[model samples]
Target: MKKLISLLLNRLTLVLLLILAQFIVLVWLINFFSNSWQNIQIALMVLSLLMVLYILTRNDNPEFKLAWVIPILAFPIFGGFFYLFFRAQNLNMKTRNHLYNVVKERQYILSQNIDYGLKGNYKKIETFLESDFWPSYKHTNSIFLPSGESKLKVLLEDLKKAEKFIFMEYFIITKSKMWDEILEVLIEKQKQGVEIRIMYDDFGSATKLPLGYYKKLRALGFKVISFNTLKVHLNFAMNYRDHRKIVVIDNKIGYTGGINIGDEYTNSTKTFGHWHDAAIKIEGDAVWTLTILFLENWRFSTKEKISYEDYYLDYKVEKPNGLYVPFGDLPLDKNHMAKDIYLSLISEANESIYISTPYLILDNEMVTALKLAAKSGIDVNIVIPGIPDKKMVYMVSESYVPELLLAGVKVYKYKPGFIHSKIIVVDRKVAMIGTSNLDYRSLYLHFENNIFLYDASSIIDMVDYFIETIADSVLITPQEMKKRNIFYRVIQTILRAFSPLL
Candidate 1:
């Protein structure tokens, strides 16, 4: 009872603090404009009008559009200009040109060597690739690592064997014993002249890392770049973070997915016991794809154009018949690739749509699509975290479960710990594994990525793993939900109302 009160009070306090801060900031801006001899208020109103029009024409989301429009409407003089200076996605022409050139060069090489070999039995995936994503690169092997412990062991081994270079980028790299071990290896590799470049999101790791984390790494001969530094002035830019966990070693080995570099993922320490997560480490041609992703973000931060040719490797042996195209999903792009890929899989699913995510908040389209799939007799199973780090999000996710269950969807709560893996396997043929959560922020507001698999090997592996995971999960039946306390259900309903913001 005390814990609940504490949580509620903390939430209330946080809300009050935010409102106070916003009011003070707005007042200060208004006062400054009023006192200015330049008639800044009149100028800002005009700028804000232009900003609103630009946002209205470009962004289609009603929620986000309202978020911007409301502020500009309330405080026409300052809010509009403030948005123009910060909220705009207007990329500099030079940056756009650089991206175009890089993409063109990368695509040209991909065309010559790689072939999308979804020819015979993989026709469904082929249509998905071309129509949805314009996927042209192929003949890549993708392996799924179901257990976090298993993935961590293999990743450590791969890091040990890296000879030339190791490119590491993640949203979180804490100063734990796990990271200490990795740091030791990175330091040793740096001393040996192996090119090491580390990139991490500043805000994500801010509390966990010391002030001079990058400086320390640089001192050890490691090239480190901090993505989007922390400052109130840069808050708008900070929202669009590099949430990718990509590790490319010697341009031959690569790893990516939901797992970050921490003891929790390895199950060595139990913050939330039995941490469930997934990741993939790829060798051969796929590593090149990840290296490019790292280089693009690295260049954006450091302004150092690293050569893709240097990282590219030539495989002499006949590779496995798996087509892998690793693409980065950007907020700047009009098309939502991650959502589109999942939607395509859901649409083409004949038997089942299995998903496991920490966050289950969805837009109207996704909610409608899932309901339709469940009603059409397609087995749609969604596994969410039982013990969520954010209790409100957990409640919000649960609120949606009953409706899906009513429509023939099966929902499971991971009884062991937080289910952090974002995975989807469609009809045992298509698989999606990545850091993207099925939430508005990931799909629309933030940059995310996923690896789409076409082969039967990984799809079966992922499906089997999901099945085994359910053994430790509690199936949420409607009868059981009916027995829940009235107070608890009310909390869930209230939490779900704010699901869109989540």
Candidate 2:
């Protein structure tokens, strides 16, 4: 009977099963409601309707607002319940105020020493920031990698040198040789009373770590906490897992980007075939921003907010050599710092705009900006993973490729492996590298960071690295894209429609 059921089950059959389960759940809940329950349900339904209307009225993203409204109109009771579970995704006034203050305070400090002298021929970045983000920061040194292999080597070398503290946080951390080596170092550091702390998303590390892994780390004298631990009731929050990969050592050196703690990130996994990732290793005042970000998340998880004065140390002047500006993105913040920075770079580019990301699902504003940049004769290019780990996401990204092609933007697929790097280079003078992917989730839902490099030399090196990687890439032409099957075409349409939520 089980074999027969398995044989009969297909994609359509599975979807039907899910629909049936949802209907059953709806019916059961409605039937179980008492008179008072019904009244309370009516009140909740009214409140939900008002909220939906308010969201639709305020939000410019029609697709995102629609994602919330469709189910509610279809089945008010069930949809309202589901929406209630996921309501935290909507920004509240409190968080908005917090973001405003955080940005203000941060800008105040960063602007004190930031040098705007690095602005070369690119006028867009300078104008946008000098007007909006209040661009500040003294100096930043950039080391751009067109390859993940090289970045990992630098990261490991940095890790080996930690003396006082090591705080490593990533979306995913597997128990492989790559991590084992780092873990061994961290363990040794802990043994030497170096204060080792690690925070990994429970969902990302679910299959990699055992249930009692936190306790195991605690036993090893390493402070460890799993962010947003998986629970059936709090499943909505689980979807908004910490997608950031940050490493701060003694608040002096830091690293952040699309790289995770696994062999796949290092391109040793046969599953993803070849992986292309980018990460930056910074040694300067910029490390402090990453330090604060880690500490904030750590405080939220551990319930002990350390004083800012303790963490914010005055950086003694060494030289005007390296000025680092590190900024972060939060789900609650509407500023969209990562996207804003990327857009600024794209808009300001005169020579070129080069981007490498695993996912590419642009909102209307982002799409418009890229289109305008390409139309203005800027050499816009993007590199995506040839082999995608998520089929739906890949199809969705592929659907958007043609539009950019029409706008004269060249797209490349990393032939060797999956390209998981979230990096953008503008005019060979400015480089932005970090954990923020060019997708709605990274833009609006996840905690992310992007380090801005103001040094002209570093930006030039980054541009050179990107050019080198492009040599290993397979350029996608318009004619070749037409060869995809109808099934894939249909899937792409459906996935793209739902990309905002994905």
Candidate 3:
């Protein structure tokens, strides 16, 4: 009874209830007006038809369009009203202007100091990223971590070396052994007068961290903010989340990948069998790019105008020679940069393509690219989780297996447990590792970050790790997929149809 009461009083639950009540009221009013007024009924029907037309004309993913169109066609009144309420994708104007000013003011100054000597296809990739405002760097050293436990050890050691400020942004931050150990170090660093700031997604950490956790951090003199804080009302803005995991120490070292702040990442707790993940540690001029990514988010969340000079490291550090292009994707931007990068990598692969992701929901464009690559006799392999964290999403992911298999794309399921790593390696010469998952949300709806390496030693390391993981994974056969029941296939089709919303 106490647990039930606690759940009912939870902030997320309360907010959801409030939103549900509002939706119910809206539906009730629509029905009442339709019965009482012929004009109102005709007007609502016309609005729904217009909404369907508008959705079809908008340049959006077909799956996303279909998800809305089917519902609107079924329930004209309420569906049109809901779509009208939630359709706008713009950030608040003030926040958008501030972000643009921050980037515009620093773009040239930051780009002038680094030179990425690119050749052949690497040059082409660099040029594309530059055109999209993601600059390539030359002086950064990249270290590909194969597991979360390995990253945590290196992260702690790097944290101990911080002299000035520490910035961390993650999708989820839970109060667990992993966070407790990191927090202890952060608290000690605070005593030494080192500045610290953290940003975490409210929706991601809703069930893990207690309410007012950010307030407690602020009281402790740590600058902390929740990304898109949840409210007791309907909010379409809440759908776009900050899903990037970034840590920058003193503007010299940075880390980003699939790992979040939880014991599961470390494989200390067996929530999903053995938890497998990956991260990349970067040092040198490229770290500054990550610092900017964090600051842009901080400025937006806090509404603070920041001088770039305050956190920018003026001195250059000697690092290994390679091209490291760290980039970000914003829902406000029309360019789907991350997905485009993945598609290009697949299309450009000459020898082999290896990928690891938690989810495998691909749109037609990506599927076509991969299929073409495989049909051309390039080795194409993908690894996903054997144990899933979300069962419905897992079912949806499985729905794509048969078509990909028929197209000659090889798919593997890690036999040990869930693999949360987001990595792609092509031809053993180019690789990308970071927070963007291979799904509609990461590609279309979330703010994400990734690093692409050209001719970097990390590419070889990533390839080696992929081979090792494949040894432990079980390759899926067409026969195995065909064994699924007809009822299950029907469910999968229904789930896949609406996967964009999932």
Report RMSD (Å) for each prediction in the order shown. 5.5, 5.5, 2.0
Residue pair clashes in candidate 3: none
Clashes of 3: 0
lDDT of 3 by residue, 139-237 (tens): 778888999899999999999989999999999998899999999899989889999999999988887788899999888779999998886434354
Ranking by TM-score: 3, 2, 1
* Residue 144 miss distance in model 2 (angstroms): 3.0
- For candidate 2, write residues 202-294 as lDDT tens digits: 877876665667898889898899886764332144345788888988777788877888887776666788777777777666677787778
Q: Judge candidate 1 at residue 148 and give its lDDT.
A: 69
User: What are the clashing pairs of model 1?
Assistant: none
- Give residue 219's lDDT in candidate 1 (0 to 100): 86
Best by lDDT: 3
Clashes of each: 0, 9, 0
Specify the poorest-scoring 10-residue window by lDDT in model 3: 112-121
Cα deviation at 438, candidate 1, in Å, is 0.6
TM-score of every candidate: 0.83, 0.83, 0.95
lDDT of each: 0.74, 0.73, 0.87
Q: Show where candidate 1 strays beyond 4 Å.
A: 1-25, 28-56, 66-139, 234-237, 316-321, 479-500
